[model samples]
Target: MSLRTKFMLALLFTGLAAVAMVGGLAYAGMTKKVDSLRRERAAEHFHASVTAYLAQYGSWEANRGKQGFDAFMRSRGPLAGDRPPPPDDERRPPPPGAGRPEPRGEPPYHFILADQEYRVLLGAGVYKHGELLPEAARKNAQAVEVNGRVVAYVSPEGVITPSRQELQYLAAMRDALWFGVAGAAVLALVLGVLLSRGLGRTLGHLTGAVRAMHGGSLLQRVPVESKDEVAELAAAFNAMSEKLARTHEELNASHQTILTQAEQMRELSVRDALTKLHNRRHFDEQACTLFSHAVRHKRPLSMVIGDIDFFKKINDQFSHATGDAVLRQVGEILRSHMRLSDLVARYGGEEFVIAFPETELPQAAALCDKLRAMIEAFPWHQVHPELKVTMSMGVYADLAAGTAEAMLQKADALLYRAKETGRNRVCFAA
Candidate 1:
């Protein structure tokens, strides 16, 4: 069952048990009181009957009445003929002066009578003739002495047993008590069911919100209806969820920013600062990878190493700033003239290198001569009209040159030879 139903059942049962216990206790107390009253009335009737019987009759008649009393006792019938027995010693025949035996069986009326010494004389029902009476019956029973004999007596005022009317009344009361308990229990059940349903609905809303959050929707919230504790709990939970959603968004933004910065840093690390080209470090790495590929594929590879002729003299005549400008201009020219597949880099101050994949030694030399002629024909004197610059180029082609460094050294040697012969010219290795 749902939580609401279970809670209602528990509350209803508790109310029912409580009402039943209270009704049972009340009924028991009332029944005891009524039974006590009935016993008291019976005692009073017994004492009165005995007293009246002794007062009207002489000794002989009284003796005769005793026989009647005995016969009544022996009859063992209903209340009509019931009587108390004579004393054990007095069970014998009466003395000569005693009167006729008492009428047989119990008298039509109830009475009690005691003699001078408080010994029983005559009695019926709950009281003995001469016995000391209980406190309940003493007030109503009359005290007397007949012929020097003391007696206490009472007459029956009403029936001393529980009447049919009283029984019916008690039975009705018991039924009413049960009915009241049942009615109260049903009312409690209804109230409990309503309360529990409200509580369960509140909990269900909270549960649905939690499930939505788990499914990646952090914006869900529980509904609040009352100003009770459940409403307060829902408010707190909504606040916490809002905080978590905001924190998640911030973390994601931060992570994306970090990733973008890392990419920029990687690009900066591989690029030359002045020339805006791959630096010597990056070129060396590429050259090694390319050389391995060329060896594996058995493809021709060629390289060019070039240097500005009399570069130190130009720097001394002008200034380092002009020398740097010259190098930057030359880097731009080389980049523009080179094919897309070729790699170019500033090797050092006034020195540069280029890689040409799938090119023979003759083709590499021709390309180097074209680049030399292009650099020599450029109008350098326009910016510094008194200055002139020239470059010497060397070409090398061989995959089995042992290493990229070895191939570059060979190219460098050829470039030194070209400078020795004349600046602004290309030279090829034997």
Candidate 2:
């Protein structure tokens, strides 16, 4: 297929995929919401029915008697029946404490009445009245109680199928989904064709510009009248053509100047602008090289991760300018304390990392402690009389540690431990 056709097909596919994903997620969320609403309503109904019944008869003990059971059966009518009703004993209610058999067989609703011990007193299921429900089924089931004690459960069996209103809602949603899919399909086709035509025209302009440039026309430029991606490309091409013409004119005089600018840009790329310290990118590059050398030579090497404590509080209480000043001071201290063989960098924010070559864990720990003490003792009166700054440090040193990444991670974890235990401390592991 042509490039335009392919691009159009890709756009169509992406649009359709997005629609399907959104529709599926929306449908799932709606389904969950509907199910939750149904359960909530069912629970409300169950509670109301139990409350009204108990109110009429007084307590569970009163309901356990023959009069109560008969009254309950009559109230529930044939729906609550599990077997032929026992012949009534009008002489006296079954001796007090004697239990009534639970109902059995499937009914429109399943209700169970159990005692304090969870033994079923009456149930509306096929199980025997006294049988225990499986633990899995009882999870999240609602309870009924008497005198501030749980005495029964009313579990509705089967999925609470959608009611008529919910079914209508689902049907409407399905219709909307179908309509959306149809609309998306048409939209995709129209957008695909338009984009293909536009891209084709833009690419044709680019091709002609390249041909003119190849024929030694350095001043040739692509017209850029819009802010679309194609226009951006055209603007970039025009700039390049202009640069080429200028370069051809001053190739001898500007060569050294260009090299100096390139070097400055490279330095800027790897240095933190605020603190004038080597940034994380530079740190990673240096760390990999140093770690490899240490490993190959079987020399001890230690890594340290440090963070300024209460740095955020300082920023909140003082201005951000003060925070930046503090960071610059900290960076100066770190750089001064480091030897030519060691590396230090502003990892990010108030955090910094240092790598020590030919040094063991104990030596690194000692150095970090010294640095922490120095930072703590620095006269913050220079900035604010009451200001106090401290740092937590963690060091890891193991020549056999397979990767630099592993050592860095260990040091980070140790730094977290130091922070958790108390601020302004140094912790180390070998």
Query: What would the TM-scores of all predictions be?
Result: 0.54, 0.42
Model 1, span 1-430: residue lDDT tens: 9777888888888888888888888899889887666556555444433444456554314547667444533443324222444555766776888987664434334445444443444545555644665555555556554666664444333334455556887899799898989897889888997887778999898889899899998876777778899889988888988988898889889999998999878768877778767788988999887788788898888878999988898899988878887888888889998998899998988899999888888988898888888888889986588878889998888777978778898899889889889778898864
Best by TM-score: 1
Q: So what's the TM-score on candidate 2?
A: 0.42
lDDT of each: 0.74, 0.78
Worst 10 residues of 2 by lDDT: 77-86
- Runs of candidate 2 with Cα error greater than 4 angstroms are 1-253
| Candidate 2 residue-wise lDDT, 138-180, digit = tens | 7645677656756566565433545556778888888887788
